[model samples]
Target chain A: MSPTGNRADWADDEDFDDPSVLPPQEVITNKDGTKTVISYRYNDDNKKVKVTRRIKTTVVREHVNPQVAERRKWEKFGLEKGHAAGPSFDTTSVGENIIFRPSVNWKANAKEAEKEGGEKGSMKDQLKDKKVKCRICSGEHFTARCPFKDTMAPVEEGTAAAPGVEAEEDAGGLGAGKSSYVPPHMRKGGAGGGEKMGGRFEKDDLATLRVTNVSELAEENELRDLFERFGRVTRVFLARDRETQRAKGFAFISYADRGDAALACEKVDGFGYRHLILRVEFAKRTT
Target chain B: MRPILLSGHERSLTQIKFNSDGDLLFSVSKDKIVCAWWSANGERLGTYNGHQGAVWTVDVSPNTILLATGSADNTVRLWNVKTGECVKVWEFSTAVKRVSFSPDGNRLLAVTEKRMGFNGTIAVLDISYGENLSAQAAEPTLTIVCEESKATVAGWSFLSKYIIAGHEDGSVSQYDPKSGDQLENVQIHEFDSQITDIQFAPDRLSFITASKDKSAKLLSSRNLAILKTYISDTPLNTASVTPKKEFVILGGGQAAMDVTTTSARQGKFEARFYHKVFEDECGRVRGHFGPLNTIDVHPAGTAYASGGEDGYVRVHHFDKSYFDFMYEVEREQARK
Candidate 1:
């Protein structure tokens, strides 16, 4: 009745004959010119009708070409046999000279050379007393076969005059080495002595801050947020005990802007954060 | 009075603004979604999609038919409000931080940061109907290069002729949108602090600026002269003057980066109110548990809304008792 093809459309079917309200039926024709009729009706609950229809159909045999059919059957049988699609290469042949040989050292060992000098005295003292230093660079090697003759080795403070011992006999300027390499920490104006907390500040470390009197409950993100208002904070490091894995009551906050770091240092210094009085300062650069 | 808290954003909210009719509220955040809500009932309407990065600023057209948003994805997007369809996209070389629609809704002004640290280029684009609708790619009508410092906030005047921007160096610059000429550049603060917000007053004759230096200043719109300074104990992230010019509300707190669950529950966030003329503290309202990043006064002057780093928007309406007290205060002042 609602146009959904439900049974409500046939409520008054008695007044007029409606084809929709008629019993569901089907007709089947047999090849022998005989017919069979089947009919069913749906109840109010719309349960499917139990009536069944059966019709026998004729099967037509298809003609096949023997040559094509044989080829297709063979192809299917080959695929079903699980054969590889490509030719396999032979790998059973043994190659020539595949045995691994350990390298033998032809040069004399330093320890053996020292032992050859003598067993009565200390090896280093015996080597020094025997004057077995390299003739080219005053090292412990022969002058003609010295390995460091071409390389640059700075002259140490105590070894400055050692090069003059063989200046005339050795290779030109080989004994007069360049100045000794000095590490940044030992160099002038290095950051070794000015370490802030446990970290060093570099030229670009203007935004880094050293905060003291930090509470153990202070988190890295909390320290970062505390200084973030000054500028964009790039990192926050809370000093912690290695074994205990607990805060060490101090932290470092790094900002992207030097001005922001300086501002945070000035404004947040001596400020109260939680139950602690924060002492904030600029971190010093250390090498 | 109790405030209605709307919580949806997962991260810090960047901005919130009401439509011209004050019926719809649009909010953007670092969560990369632009959400719309019914202002009166606080019911979520829908979200604007298609942005691949954090949306920093949002503005509704004067006609309330379109919305413009700027995002860190280096794009300026325009959306059809009713259909939630992205109508157009304008690409930039850097992240767009702030965006504003003109009074006529025919043009858009945006501040695009060059890379990360301060320094951005101000672009004024004509967004009206043009010949080519083929995802129209049009150059900005005017480009003002901010060389000294990156501007953090920007706004277009009511007349749509002047562009005002605040920089990280606590300086304000006024530019002509037509010729790209800089009309005025003034350093308003002595400490050279980062300018967090800049907005034109409802009167359109003055403007307000908030800075990380723990202060907010009201300046004359014409010559950029300070008329009043509202000082706060903590850093002020945002400030707004009432529509009737009766009160100034400043919102701020301890840095959001430091807010732990314990500290937040202690109620550190607040919005402090001050008398406009006397600059005296009137009262303070506490609700948010995190730093307030943005505050916008209702056009009707009876209510105001704030978005905070705690990912909530709290809309506070003035109570009747406060209105009565303010009336009495005004009457006593008039007798003098």
Candidate 2:
């Protein structure tokens, strides 16, 4: 039987019939103007008996919905296949909102610590169960009172003075008063951060060089090769034509080592690369 | 090749951007500080301070002289990169979530969420105007208030003629910068879907959007018709398109709350690269320990940077072998 047109093909099949099952009915009108029909079964119940439709065993075994099957295949490939009208019932009732989904809980550990340990405890006991360290310096102190919190232009001169005095009073000072000085922005109650230790690379490690009269045929690799010997070329952002996606006469080159960058600036500056002069300089550091 | 990781932020990294020159890398975190880095050497420059709240987004002017930041403090601040001082602050009645600079660097676009209503507002300010003015004098040049939806992302189309904003309800609204007239407001995804990011392709004919519904789509910049979809196993938080490689990088992870106990957590933290034409994943990059919040491809297309909930920014460059593979793929597309 054709999978899509199952009813007609199933009706035509004559193999293995069951006597108890009733066939679908058809009505006809005679020339005498009376309607006539033949029936193998009678509706004895006061309520009209309903007819049942059955598919052939072979047809039922072979048919498949391509769309649904294709969706399943994509799911295995790690891609969601279709769009949802809105969030599923589970998400709306549980996930909350986009910024804060039910799946994320950044405050989970902090909440657990507060619930079990209570507020009056030593710094160790207070953060004993917490997953993250102080957000300011990633130090042992509370995020609000982290000593490194003052790194960003101390909000109030008085607060910066307070930390120094507190440091002396607590001989083995733990950074406690730090929490009370939460920055104005952080204290306003959106997503706040804890302090992290200073990161690698200082202000002096950066230098920017420019390539002038770059050939349209020049590729990123060629520019990188020209400066790679001077130092590690971190990035080469080639200005290109929007339409053809070709070099647009100039490119900026950045280096990983300050000394190497400076040397490249002095030596390569005004030098020729593929017959084009290079403009090299310490790109002004954004204060 | 291994990715160069920059560590410093004490909290979740919210956004990262390469300046117009690609010499500087700026990253903002929930920590309330925006740190600048030498993109080439992974050197940390000075941090831009003054926001009293978590900064949501940041952008640099095309001239590379000024930086604009949006924050939950309900203000948009412009800073002189050389001075590290906030040159001007524009206050609003709502939190500013996204900011963008026009190609010409003369205007700044900000998307702000109202304090109480569903409507998000887009304000286009003439940054070239002199600083320090009365509240009335500082009014935006154009304002497009979204109805029944709050914007999550906003930007100026290439050429700076149009302003487009994406909303929490999967609706994208466009406005004529000249008159502030609403031109098109269409639902680009299923209802109740949130737009995570909207980045225009280098060519500007199309833009890509990442949605919380586990799909990233490439749509016509003009009509907003979805041209292609890049679906993923986890809800995508951000996405970026590489101009040269023709690959889309998608990032996300299990919700922070579920990470500790979930058995299938690995898939959530990996950034998958998908072929733009085939929609098939080319490869996966695994490095981030937590959910990735943002990803940005350098204009040169040789490298990309990502920030994550782990409070670290990672910069990945294409190695020789990777470039070879890209060239092979490019040839295949050209032949087709």
Candidate 3:
């Protein structure tokens, strides 16, 4: 209740003239069983701020033994003597919520979850296929090991010998590489359609084939062996049951080249293995 | 599930126990004070402030009328659970490491540490629910002294038929409760790896022993037969068998001294859940910053509380998923 109505004279309005004086809080009950509270307070900057909060109260009734109900009324004693009701701030607090789901393959699940959140593991995986390119001669070797290291500077620092290398180095190094975001179409060398998302993995996906109708006893190494005849298989992932650890009758095989993947798909389709005919097709792009 | 944290202890927590009703939780710590809290909300009901030294262990009577605590003060003190007043104190030659109430609440046992010139002993005192709560027996009814190896933790078996004691040498012994004579002794864990904690199953027919050898074993209390073993990477500090759910919660981590040398993930300060029958690790709930020193399951198995070396007691109520988890065979059996 505000004191404005209780004031005896208009001169009492002097209290409101002060900038520090805050208006009385107002609370209104809504029809939907919620209460709206509006209050005024001075913030850290000495500016008047209005706060609004909606409060909803729900009653949860629990049945318990009468003895427990009686014990709940016991008085605080010893060190906590004379304390008020509810948990004290110093002695009790609610901690972060923990998702505790029990599963048979908890170890494997935990490792996978950790790998997703772990920076070191993901960073290693990201740089798994990254190569060391010589800055001077564009060879598959370190710049210090390049044959032209003694005579030539790094392509980025060189003057006129390698224009293509300079442009490539500029696009990779100084041209919107870090510190700022540049749209794909606006980046250097953007005329030929800039690099796509997923980086090197996009090329690997093009060389991946989805093999279905595989026998449940199929193993990753077995699939790798079957697919490696066409070309060097980069990865073979066989879906398996988490509990039984048995293959789920499908697998994905990625080759080093899309041509090898196409050849494998054409030859492996409808091929019999373990009394089941396998159906092979190019793995569809996922999202 | 959101865990409620109780921060009444300033130093590391030693033990925590839930009353038979599962409504009240009692926790003792190395800070010399015992705290009683409502298990549902983690509201501190009161504090037992008479212990002069760090309290090593605590147990509430089956009726929840008396709370007994063993402390480094070399005494076992019984307190009126509701009033938080010390009812009786029994002095011993060495520090008391563990205290437990019998199944019927008529007898109390205290495990005294082997220190100075005294050998470790498990003494049973006759508890009375007389008109005056302070009117407890002054002397123990029987004392079982361990001459070869010191007993670290002990508890009463089913129907109080036997007293099971876990020793410093990782051996478990069953003794006749009436005569205090050793009935049988068996090495349940690795030799010389001390047994840190022993908690009885809901039926008391079996018990779980946590040892410094990084393993917890469920042994039949009658014959000390190892029924199942749950192994972990870090040494275990405490283990408890949940009642309704066929799960056992094991808590441990790197020793508190070595905690500074390892990160929290490496420290393994999470509560691991193992299938009681299958002995497979089902899940883990991580929260504590330090080693978990003690764990107690709710009598009804709806919730569990853990005390950590970080000086906080966390009470977690089980979620629906905890109960819904079932192996394929179990699901198949349920379908039948």
- Per-candidate clashes come to 10, 19, 0
* Whole-model lDDT per candidate: 0.71, 0.69, 0.88
Per candidate, native contacts kept equal: 0.00, 0.00, 0.95
Q: Assign candidate 3 its CAPRI class.
A: medium
lDDT of 3 by residue, B123-171 (tens): 9999999999999889998998999999999999999999999999999
DockQ of 3: 0.62
Q: Which one wins by lDDT: 2 or 3?
A: 3
Q: For residues A125-183, what per-residue lDDT tens digits would candidate 2 score against the true structure?
A: 77668775654334456767644344322323433454454335443222343553544
TM-score of each: 0.51, 0.52, 0.69
Highest-TM-score candidate: 3
DockQ of 1: 0.00
Chain B TM-scores per candidate, in order, are 0.91, 0.93, 0.98
If the candidates were sorted by their TM-score against the true structure, best first, what order would they fall in?
3, 2, 1
Q: Which TM-score value belongs to model 2?
A: 0.52
Model 3 chain A lowest lDDT segment of ten:
A151-160
Instruction: Give candidate 3's iRMS in Å, 1 decimal.
Output: 0.7
* Model number with the top lDDT: 3
Who wins the DockQ comparison?
A: 3
